[model samples]
Target: MKERHTSLLMFGLIASIALFFMLNLVLGSVEIPVRAVIRVLLGEEENTIWRNIILKSRLPQSLTAIMAGAGLAVSGLMMQTVFRNPLAGPSVLGISSGASLGVAFVILLSGSIGGVALSQLGFIGEVTLTLSAIAGSLLIMILIAYVSQKVRGNVSLLIMGVMIGYIATAIIGVLKFFSAEEDIRAYVIWGLGSFARVSGGQTTVFVVIMLVVLPFSFLLTKTLNLLLLGDSYARNLGLNIKRARLLVISCAGILVAIVTAYCGPIVFLGLAVPHICRGLFHTSNHAVLLPASLCAGASLALLCNLIARMPGFEGALPVNSVTALVGAPVVMWVLFNKRKSER
Candidate 1:
């Protein structure tokens, strides 16, 4: 009976993802008819304006939301599991901070040092930000990997990660203080986060990269489940705790890095989705929770994206705002329910 229920819930999540995805393409600032959207997707629409709007804008944005949501949620789950803390988010290891610091240097420093604002450089600016974010995140990830091997305790490693984040934030703050007003404004906009930030061929590459990396997470499900049994027991069962910790951290760090590189530092989805999945499925098993988080994350992100672009507001709201507003309540509800059940 429980298995059947879980299956139904999974089905519901997938259905919601599809519904929201279609709604995203159909309902935007300029209303496109459902039929027209379908026709455009099917390559039967002849109206170039509607076609371009759907293909060039909505399609890529929706895809980006999916990939970003799934990647972040999975990364969060891994972080929580490895650290044994429900509050352990994808950003807990400072990978996102590293990415942000990189962008800070590019957007903040270019104005002060180069005498030319990189933010005004258009495509060149965007490319530079993406690359810098990747480089910064990977660099931190490498450092974390090294520290993981040196430090035997997860707590020690976690503390080091937090200190690294603080150091990065301090550097970014110093840069922002010295940066020009326009550069600071540009940096703030990027910090707000946006699915629309990625478009055209970039969207395809982002989705493809996520598709490649996400499946590798599933491969760690068993390792994750064993880790849940605690280090001593897991070791008794022949699990290499050190190696497993490194792999999980590496996997989660890479996921966070990639998503942050492309989408900016999207919050809440990573921290909330795993809890949402656990509440829905009522299980700690990674095999179940992992996929559940993936689908739930995609659906939630699509819903947030849809709301952000809903017809009321001109342009679109920042994705980070919508996510925090939507995700915070859900997380609170899950926690409330869990506490009530315990009582």
Candidate 2:
């Protein structure tokens, strides 16, 4: 009966997500009618501008919202499970900051160097930016992991992650101080967090990266389940805790980095979506939680994207702002409730 209920909830969430996606297609800056959008997509009408807006602008933006939502949510769940911190998330743990720093360097520093466009750096720049971001995130993850092993307190590790994030942000501020106006302006625009920045070709790259990381995360479900049983119990169950941790971190890192690169920093979907799913489904089991979070995240993201196009709002709210509004309240409620219950 419970299984059937979960299936029904998932179906309902997915249906809502699909409905919102079509709505996004219909409503935008220009407010194309739904019938016109369908006609444009079908190539039944010869409106080039409408066709371009639908195909080039709205479609990619909506697709970006889906991938970013799913990636960040899953990454958050993995980190939360690994660190055993409800607050553990890509943004909170300094991972997203690391990616932001990498992007800032390419956009700000490189651009200031007379004639060095990041695009001129080509595949090399892409590799460098991606690798540097990954390295920065891994450094923080490893530090937190080590602290978790040494300190014997979850709060301390979480605080340490917060400190790491601040440190990264401070470094970024220093970089900004020395950057030229034009480069700084470019970086600031990117920092506002839009789903419209990623091109169609880049979407293919993100999809491939996600596909690779998703399987590893899925395969680790058995280990993850045993993990929630505590280290000693997991060891007794023949799961190598170290290997499990490594795989989880690696998968989460890749997904987080990819989303950050493509969509800028998406805040809170990761931290909030998993908790929402847990409450709705009443299970910590990764099998159900993973898929449930995916649907919920996608649905919420599409909803937010739709709301972002609010009537008379200037140029849509930044994606991060929308997510933060949703995620922050959930975090506060969880913490306060947990504290009260503990008392």
Candidate 3:
């Protein structure tokens, strides 16, 4: 009976998510009727404008949102599980900050030298930025894990991670101060995250990166489950603790770096989405939890993307702003309730 109930709940959530996604495609900056959206989707295009809008704009945006949502949520789940802290995330580990810092340096240095936009640098800048960001993330990730070994308390690790983020931000601010005005302006604009900025080609890049990393994360399910049983227990169970930790952190860094490269720093989806999944599903089994988080994250992001297109705004809200706006309340409620339960 419980199994039947779980399956029904999962099916319901998936169905609702699909419905919202279809609605998202139909309602955007220029409203295309639902019928036209179906036609375009089914390749029976009756209107060129609707076809163009669906294919050129909404489709790519939706795809990017899906991949980003899944990637970040998985990263967050892994980090929280590895750290054994509900609040620990990609942001808390300073991984996103490291990526942001690398992008900032690229904008500053490249602009001064060649007066070229990083996007204009094409594959070269993408490669450079990705490498730098991954390097930065790995460095911070290692530092945090090391500190975590020594720190003992989960709360102390969280505080250390926050301090690391602040240090990275301070360095970025100094870099910005030294940067030329044009470079500073470009970096600032990039900091305001956007899903629209990811081109179809960029989406392919992100998809490839994610595809390479996500399976490895999925494979770590057994190890993750073991680790949750505690380090001593995992060792007794013959899991290579160091190797498992390294693999998990590396996979997470790759996911974080790719999203940061294409979409800029998306804030709360990584932090909040997995918690939502856990609450809804009432399980921590990664096999179930992982896919559930993916669907929930994608649905949440698609909803945010839709709201970003709502009328009465001169420009769409940044994707980060929309996610934060929605995710903040949800996270606050969780934290508040958790505190109350403990008391």
Best by TM-score: 1
Candidate 1 deviant stretches above 4 angstroms? 341-343
Candidate 2 lDDT, tens digit per residue, 234-290? 889998776777677667877787787777777778889988887677689999988
Q: Write the per-residue lDDT of candidate 3 for residues 1-343, one digit (tens) a residue.
A: 7578668867876786787788778886688888888889999987888898888778878878877888888989988887788877778778778877877777777776767867567667766766666666667777876776577555676788788888889989988877788778767767887777666676677777777777777888898888788778888999987677767766787788777777778889988988987766667788877777777777888878878877754255778888999998987787677667667
Clash numbers, per candidate: 0, 0, 0
lDDT of each: 0.93, 0.76, 0.78
Task: Order candidates by lDDT, high to low.
Answer: 1, 3, 2
lDDT of model 1 at residue 213? 97
Who is ahead in TM-score, 2 or 3? 3
Give per-model TM-scores: 0.97, 0.85, 0.87
Candidate whose lDDT is highest: 1
lDDT of 2 at 56: 81
List runs of model 2 lying over 4 Å from the truth.
39-45, 115-160, 329-343
Residue 161 displacement (Å), model 1:
1.2
Report the C-alpha lDDT of model 1 over 1-343, residue by residue, as the tens digit: 9999999999999999999999999897788999999999999999999999999999999999999999999999999999888888988899999999999999998898999999789877888999999999989999999999999777888899999999999999999988899999998888888889997989998999999999999999999999999999999999999899999999999999999999999999999999999988989999999999999999999999898988885455899999999999998898899888877
Q: Which window of ten consecutive residues has the lowest lDDT sum in model 3?
A: 309-318
